[model samples]
Target: MSDPALVTIPARRGKAARVKQGQIVKVINTHGDQVVDTWAFNADDLNEFMSMEHTRPHIMKIMPAVGDAMLTNKRRPILTFIEDTSGGVHDTIISACDRYRYKFLGVEGYHDNCTDNLQAAMGELGLAAPETPCPLNLFMNIPVHADGSLSFEPPVSTAGSYVALRAEMDLVIAFSACPQDILPINGVGHLPTEAHFSVD
Candidate 1:
């Protein structure tokens, strides 16, 4: 094992974990219907990070599949989607939530958001966000409408449903237990909860 399963990512928070090449990382929604915004970077070079802009066209499928490789900005493989238990529903188009989003949504006061979550995790790794990038929204339900617009729906993953990815290169994986209650990304209460991560 390159790294053992780390601790539960607290509700409305995030963390960064290391997974070496050939190691597997699994993200689990223990409470069910929770969305985890995940980002990855090359451990040796943070600038060569995962890029949805490149991965989207390369795959040509909005919804990726098992064996599909999520690519980096330079079009290199980052992680291979080896297993998906929630019928492969995920998002590559949406960016992580930030404070501006809440303010735009008329949410009063300060809020814990995904952008900050990722930043915190990155800071821990002595890294920085050179640019804002869209993440792989695991278990998120954003359907492409007939008109090419998008619609949000509740996730179908039950408790214990998980997605597994094997690192293609040494990587620093970061994640946030999304904190978008108003968007209904987490279903009814919009209340966030703990999630699990294990490296094997």
Candidate 2:
């Protein structure tokens, strides 16, 4: 087992996480208040991208648990959940942070949105530039209300809790260490989070 420690990477504007065919990368929520909206695509084909619409239904309304497999739009396995200590891995509800959302949420000043990071990731991988969409918000706490409404809440994960995933394909994983100030994930402060990758 790898040691549990906080590793901080400088936030590059448009760089993605490029992992080889059989490598494992872990994104840790070192600080209790942070959210990371992530997406994955085939390293060779841009069309083969992660789809929340396809994934949400397959998960069968239950939030992702430890050891659950994440599927892509083509029904290809992307990543398998290896650790989920928070017990609040919300895969369906929270959308990726973008510029339009920033304006709508009264946070227009923050141009360095999640989409930028995703685009950067793609560029780094030498993949075709594609329009970004709603991404999977990891470590984010979005609770479902009794009336079926969703409310963003403080992170359920503590300072040291983390979620791990094993890549099932040669994937280009793009993530935005979400700079969301309007939401609670960053404690309403839009603080940056830490990330680390290692071969298992």
Clashes of each: 1, 5
Best by lDDT: 1
* Candidate 1 residue-wise lDDT at 60: 90
- Tens digits of per-residue lDDT, candidate 1, 27-110, equal 888778899999999998888889888998999988788989999999999999999887678999888889899999999999
lDDT (Cα atoms) of all candidates against the true structure = 0.87, 0.68
Q: Report lDDT (Cα) of residue 72, candidate 1.
A: 97
Worst lDDT 10-window in candidate 1: 1-10
lDDT of 2 by residue, 32-89 (tens): 6567777878777767777777776777764777766777889887877777765565
Q: What are the runs in model 1 whose C-alpha is more than 4 Å off?
A: 1-6
C-alpha RMSD by candidate, in order: 2.4, 3.1
